[model samples]
Target: MSRVRLLFLSLVFLVAGSVQADVVNKNVDTAVDISTQLVKIAHKVTVENVGKTPVKSLIFGVPAHIKERLSFISAKVGEHQLRLSETKVDNQEGGFWKLELRSDITAGRTLPLSIDLVLGRGLIPHPSQITQKEKQLVLFEGNAYYFSPYLTEKQTLTVNLGTSSVESFARVQPVSQSDTKITYGPYEKVAPFKEERLNIHYENNSPFLTITKLERVIEVSHWGNIAVEETIDMEHQGATLKGPFSRYEYQRETQSGIASVKSFRTALPASAVDVYYRDDIGNISTSHMRVLSDSVELELRPRFPLFGGWKTHYTLGYNVPSYEYLFNQGDQFVLKMRLMDHVVDDMYVEELTTKIILPEGCHSIELTAPYSVKRLKDTLHQTYLDTKGRPVVSVSKSNLVENHIDDFELRYTFAKVLMFQEPLLVIFAFFALFLLVIIYVRLDFSITDEEENSRVEREQKDK
Candidate 1:
C-alpha cells in the first residue's frame, strides 16, 4: 500500500471511533421547606457520542423504583420516547428510552435532556367521593418524590451511572431527624431518632392518595342541650395509586400485611356520646364505637379498602347533654373546646377554619384564638324563635400544619340579659304605640258652644 493511502485509512478509523463513544451527565435541584408543605425539584441530563461512526439509536435508563412517584416525564430535546422495560435478571421494571437523530451527520454533537420533579405524599382530589355528604376541609399537602422514612436526613440522595465519565450535579441538605420527628431540607438539621425509620417503595399502581386528620368538638349546654361541631382535613402529597387493584391480593395482604401506604386510624374525643361514620352511599357497617364515662372512641373502617389513588369519605356526629356549656362565668357565659386530633407529626397548616355559636341574650361579644387568623366575620343564625338571634363567628388561616394545633384557641362573650331583652323590647314598643293613640283621642275637643246650640235647635224644629 502507498504511504499516503495508509495514512488516510488510519485517520478515517480514528474519526469513526469518536462518533460511537457513549457519554452521560446528570444534575439535580431540590428545595425543602415544611412551613408550606411544598418541595420543588428539577433534573437535567446530557448525553453524547464520541465514536467515529454515526450512531443510529441510543437508550438512556432511569431507576426502576421511580415509576410510582413520577408525576410527569418528557424529553427536553430531540424526538425521544420513554418506555418501561423489564430487566432480564430480576424481571423488575425499569425506565427505557429510544432517541433518533432527525438527520444523520458527523459525530461530535451532544443531546441535552431535562425532567422536572414534584414530589410529596401524593395528590388529593377536590369534591372527593369520601366527603360528598359532608363539608371538605384540607389542611396540608407535601410534594416530595421517593420519601424514605428509614433514610437518615444526613444521607444524601445519590444517582449512580456505571461509567466514570458520567458527571452529576446535586444539592442536598438536612432538615430534621429525631426520635419524635423526621424531616428534610431547605431548613436546619436536627438529631436522629431511636425508632426504626419506615421505608416506602415507589410503586406506580394508582394516580393519587391522601392522608387526612379530622377532629369534631361538641359543647353541651344545660338549658338548650347545644352541640357544636368542627372538622379538619389533611392529605398526603406525592404519587398516586395506579391501575385496578386486585381484591384477592388486597385481602391476603390485610391478614399478613406489615407495610401500607394508605391506611390510617383516627381517635375521637372522650365526651362523645353517640357516633356515626359513613361515606357517599350511606352507613358503613365496618365502624365500631366504644363509650367511656370520660370520653368515647370510634373505630372507622372505610367501605372499600383504601389504597393509593383511591378515596373514601366519612362523617361523625354525637349529642351533648344540656347545661354542660350554658353556665355563666362571672356574669358572662364562656364557650370553649378542642376540635381535632392526630394532625400528621410534621405537617403544617395550609388553611384552617373555626366557627363558634353563642346562646341567646348573649351580647357585646369578645373573641380570640391561639394561632393567627387571616380573616374573621360574624353573622346571625336564626333557630328556635331566638329573638336576639345567635352570633356565628368564622375564622380562616393559611400555611398551617399539625404542629401548630397546640397554639389554637377560641374565646367569646355575650350579654346574658340580651337573650330575653330583645323579646321584651318588641312587646313594650307595640303597647306604647297603642296607649299613645288612646291619649290623643281623649284630649281632642270636638264641639264648640255655638256649634252645639245650632245642632240642638235644628233637631227640635225637625221634631
Candidate 2:
C-alpha cells in the first residue's frame, strides 16, 4: 500500500510540472533608467500558452544579487492593474512574484503585461570614496536578460545612462551604444534562470539622500483642524568622504562638493498651512517655501551641506482643515489621508511608522492600507481636555520608496455629542468656581454675623 501511494504522488507531481511549463515568454522588451539614485526598470512582456492547458498566472523573478534591494514592483494590463503576491518558486533561488491574470490564457493565446520595478541601493560607488572636489562615479551591475521563470523566445534590453559621459558597459553581442543610451540585444531563445553580467560604469551626480527613519503623526480633531508632524532622520548614502573637510575650500571653490547635497525641495499639500521646519537646535531659517497652485514647495537646507556619509535630523509640521480629510455620517467617522507623502523625488525610506490619533470617545476603529504593513498595538494618547484619552492607530513598514505615497482609510465610530464634551467640561468648571466666589464674599467667615454685631454695637453705645 505504501509503494502504491508513492507512485500516485509521483505521477501527480509530473503532471503539475507539465502544466506549469506550458507558459512561455513570446517577447520581452526592457527599459532601464539609471538616471538617478534609483534603478527603474519597465518590462513590456508578451506571454503565450503553448500547451493544451490554459495558463492562469505568470512568474517574475529577480536575480539573487539584487533581490534584497528590490523596493517596489507592480504589474498592469493596459489601464487596469493586476494583483501580485510573493510565492516560493521550487528549485529556484531568488525573489519571485506571481501575477494573477485577469483571464486565463487559452491554448495558443497570448497576453501582454507591463511590469515596473524600482530598486534602492542598486548602484555601487566604484571608487567607494571621493574628495570634496572630485566628481562621483558609480557602477551598475545587472542581468542582460529579463530574469524570469519561463523561457523567453525574444527579448531586448535598453539602458538609459542620462549622461553622454559613458565610462563603459557590458557588450553581450548585437550591442550598440548611442549618445546616452545603450542597447543590448535582440537575443533569441533564452533559457530560464539565465544571467549574463551587465555592468555600467558612469558618472552620476544625483542627490543620494536617504531617510533612515521617519515618524509621522496625524492628530485628528473634532473641532475642524487636523495637525500633522513628521520627524525625519536622514543620511547621505553616497560615496564616503576621503579626507578632512575644509569649509574654506568648499565656500571658495565653485566646483567643490558636486556630489554633496545642499538642498532638496519637498512638496506639501497645497492646503498645508503654518508649515515649519526645525532641528534639535531650534528653527532652521535656511529654508524657503513657495506656494504653487497645487503644492507648496519647501526648499529645505540643513545647517550645513551634507557630504557623503553625512547625517542630519529635522522635524516638519503643518496643519490642514479637518473637512478635507475627515468625513462623517451620523455617528460614524472616516479619515482618508496619505500614509506617506513625497519626501523627495525618488526618495527611499528605510523605516516608516505612521500614527493616527483619533478624537476621544472613538471606538470600533479599523484601518485600510494600500499595501501590506505591520499593524502595531493600539495605544491611548492623552492631550489637553482628554478624559479617556484619544485612540492612536499605528502601522509600520520598511524598505519604502516614493511609490508608497498613497492614501490610507481609517474608519471608526464617534458619537456626535462627544464633540461638546470638552467645551461643556470647561463651562461647568468655570460656573462652579464663580458660585463659590459669590458665597465666599457675601457670607461672614468669623464666628459672629456682621449684621448682628453692628446691632449690638449700636445698643451698647445708646445705653
Candidate 3:
C-alpha cells in the first residue's frame, strides 16, 4: 500500500469511530458538594440504550491516576445496587468500569442511574505550602463531562466550590463561571474520546479533614440494650503551617469558628442515650448533647483546636434500646445498623475497623455490608461470666467516604437455653463454694476435739 493511502485510511477510521461514539445523555442532574473536607459529586443521569440487544452493563471512564483515591461509593439503578467491573468500552476503547444493571434495559429504552463519587485527595494546595495565618487556596481539576468512553449528547456540568470567592478558573467557550459554582455545556453531539478540561482555584480555609484510623464497636445484647462506640484518630490534611503555630492568632480565628476545627457535630438516633465523649486525657467537658424530636445532636470539642497537619484522637459513644435495631424472626436474630454511623463532615477514613459483638453463646453467624468491605473475620470474645465467650464479627475497610456510609446486616442464632446457661453456672459455682467452706469448718483436728465434745455434752443435756 502507498504511504499516502495508508494515512488517509487511518484518518477515515478515526473519524468514523468518533462519529459512532456519541451517546445520548438524555438528562444529567449533577450535584457537587465542596463545602466540607472532601469534594463529593453525584450524578442522576438518564441515558438511552442504543444497542439492539438489551444493554446489561455500562463502561464509564475515570481519571486513572485519581481512581485509586476516588471512592466509587454507590451506583444504583432504580432502587437496586448496580454491580461494577473493570472493562473496555467496545465502541470506544478506554479504561472504564462496567456498571452492570440488575435488570437489562431493552434497546431504545432509557436507563436512569444515581452514582456517588468522592475524591479522597481532591483538593491540592496551590502554593505548594502556606503559613499558619494565611488562608488555604485549593486547586482542583476535573473533566467537564463524566469521563465516559462514549461521547455525551447534551450533557451539563455543575461545580460547587468550597468558598464563594473563586480566585481563578479556566474559561471554556460554553462554560459560565459563577461566584461559587461553574456550569458547562449542554452541547449536542460531542465527539468521543475527548476531554474538556475544567480547573478552579478557590479559597477553602476549612481543615481538609481525614480520619487516620477509626474503630467502631457495636455490642448487641439480648438484655434490652445496644451500645455503640467509635474511636477516631483524626488529622487535618490541609496545607501544613510553615512554622510553629501562633496560639494567640489561632485562638482569635478559632474562637470565631473560622478556618479551624475547634468543634464537630453529628446526629444520633433519637432513642440514643447515655452519650459520652472522651479523649486520651479522659472526658471532654466542652461537649454538648441536644435531644431533638427525631434525632439527638451531639457536638464535641477536642482538647485543642485542630490546625493544618495537626491531629487529635477521641471516642464518642451512645446506647440505643435493643428493640430499635434488633429484630427477632423465629429462631434467628437480625441486627440492622450503620457500620460506622457518622463521623465529622466530608470525612475520609484511611482505615476503619467495625466489630459486632453478639451476646454470649451466639453461633451460626452471618454478616453482610451494603458497601465493599476489605477484611472480615469471626472470632470469640471473652468478658465477665463468659463461659464460652461471645461471638465477634470483625470487618475492616479503607478509604471510606462520608456519604458512602451504609447499614450492615448481621444475622445470628442465639439459643434460649444458652441464655440461662451462664446464670445456672454462676449459681452452681457459688453453691459449691459455700459447701466447701462448711465442710472445712466441720473438720476436727487435735485440740478442736475437746471443744466439739463439750458442745455435744451441752446440746445433749439441753435436749
Candidate 4:
C-alpha cells in the first residue's frame, strides 16, 4: 500500500478504537417518596471493550448534585476491583470524575462502577426513626434526577413506604418529562414493616414564647446584693380557636382529650430566691412556686390558655445574695451567674443589655461570651455615684435557633477595690456633709439670743 493509504487506515483505526473505548454500560436505581424523609440513589457503570486492541483507561463522570448526597459504596472492574476517588474537574459546583483503568483495556473486557447516595433537603440528616406519638415528623416531598450520556437507557424508579400504603394521589414525574402520573404500590397487601411514621400526632403542650427584650443588670453594691431582672414578651403558637370557645365544651374536652398546646413551667436554680413572674398590668395570681434545697421551680400558669398567634408580656425579677455568685479570689472579686436556661422555645432575643456595676476603684474591665454572638456592642454606663462608671455590654442575636443556647457563656473581669471603694465613698460623703452642717450651726449666734437682741434693738430705734 502507498504511504497515504496507510496513513488513512491508521486514522480510521484510531477513531474506531476511541469510540469503542468510550462505550460504557450504565445502570441507575433511584427511590423516593414522601413517606421517608430522604431519597436514596444508586448508580452502577460498566465498561466493556469490544474492539480487537486493548484500551489504556476509561473516564466516568457524575453529576455535581449527585455527589453531594451520593457516596461511592463500591466499584469493581474485571478481576481487579477499582478504587474510586473524587476529583474536581471544572469550576462548576457538581463537576467531578472517577478514574478507572489507567492501562490499556484488553479485547472484549468489562469494567463496573457502583455507587450509593442518600440525598435530602439539607446538610442535616433526617431522623431515621420518627415516633408516631411525638408528632414531630414532617413529610419531605421533592424531586431528584439522574443524567448521563453514556447510559442512553432509561430505568424505572421504585419507591416503597414500608407498612403505610402509598397515598393514591401521590404523583411521580421524570426530570426530562413535564407530565406526571399517579401510581399504586407495585406489591399487593404485604406485611407491614416496622417503619417510622412519616406523619405523627403528639401532645405539643409547651407554649412557644419569645423574649423580645431582655435586660440583665448586675449591680455590685457596697451592700452585698446582685439583682437580675428579665422582661419577656411571650406568645403562644398552638392551634387556633375556631368560632367561639365554650367553657363547657373546653372543660369537657379537657377531661376527655389531651391538650395540644404546651403550658408554661419555669425552672430556676436552687439558689434562686424571691422569684416573681408578673404580666404587663400586674402580678398573675395563677403562678405558683416550689422551692427545694437544690433548686427552685416556678410554675407560671398564664391567666388564659395560650393559643397560636396569641402574645403576652411579663416581667420577672429576683435578687441573688452577694455570696451566691460573687466570690473572692485572693484580692480580686469574681462574679459569675447563669444568664438563661434552655427549655425555652422560640427564644427571639431582640436585644440583650447587661450592665455589670463594679466597685468605685475597681479597674481592668474585661468581657467574654461563651456562646456564638450574632452582634455585640459595649459601652460605659455611669450611675448611682459611680466615680469611673460601670461597664455595660450589649449583645444582639437574630433568628437564633434553640441549639445555640447551650454553647453560650459570658465572662468579664474587674478590679476588686471597687468592692470597698463604693461603700466607703458613700459613707464618708454622707458623714462629712452631716458634720459640716453641725459645725456651721454651732459657730453661728444662738437663735433665741439673736431674736431677743433684734427685738430690743427695734424697740430702742422706735422710741
TM-score of each: 0.43, 0.91, 0.85, 0.51
Can you write out model 3's per-residue Cα lDDT over 1-463, one digit (the tens) per residue? 4334433433433444332222344566777666666777788888775546676566556665447558655688878888877655445543466787777777678888898788888778776567766777888776666665444455777888845888877776687867777777766554445666667788887767789999999988887999999998999877776767677877666433255577888888899989999888899899888999998988878888777778998888989999988998776999999987777766788899999999987778888888778656688889888877888899998887776678988888877777787788899999999999999999865677778999999999999
Alpha carbon RMSD to native, model 2: 6.1
Give lDDT: candidate 2, residue 337: 98
Q: lDDT of each prediction vs. the true structure?
A: 0.41, 0.89, 0.75, 0.47
User: Where is the poorest 10-residue window by lDDT in model 1?
Assistant: 187-196
What is the Cα-based lDDT of residue 145 in candidate 1?
A: 31
TM-score of candidate 4 relative to the true fold: 0.51
Q: Please give the clash total of every predicted structure, in order.
A: 60, 0, 0, 17
Measured with C-alpha atoms, the lDDT of residue 268 in candidate 4 is 68
Candidate 1: global Cα-lDDT?
0.41
Better by TM-score, candidate 3 or 1: 3
- Listed per candidate, the RMSD to the true structure in angstroms reads 20.0, 6.1, 6.4, 14.1
Candidate maximizing TM-score: 2
* Candidate 4, 1-463: lDDT as tens digits: 3334433433332333222323433334444332322334445545455457776544344454434444223344445555555554332344345555646667667655554444433122123222212222223332233333232223344444332322222233322211231222222111111111122222222333545556555566536777767777665433333345445654665432122243566666677677777887788778778887876777777666554455667777777777777766665555666444432533334445444555545555444554435435556677777776666655554333332343223334455555676578889999999999999988956578778999999999999
Query: Which residue pairs in model 3 clash with each other?
Result: none
What lDDT is obtained when candidate 2 is compared to the true structure? 0.89
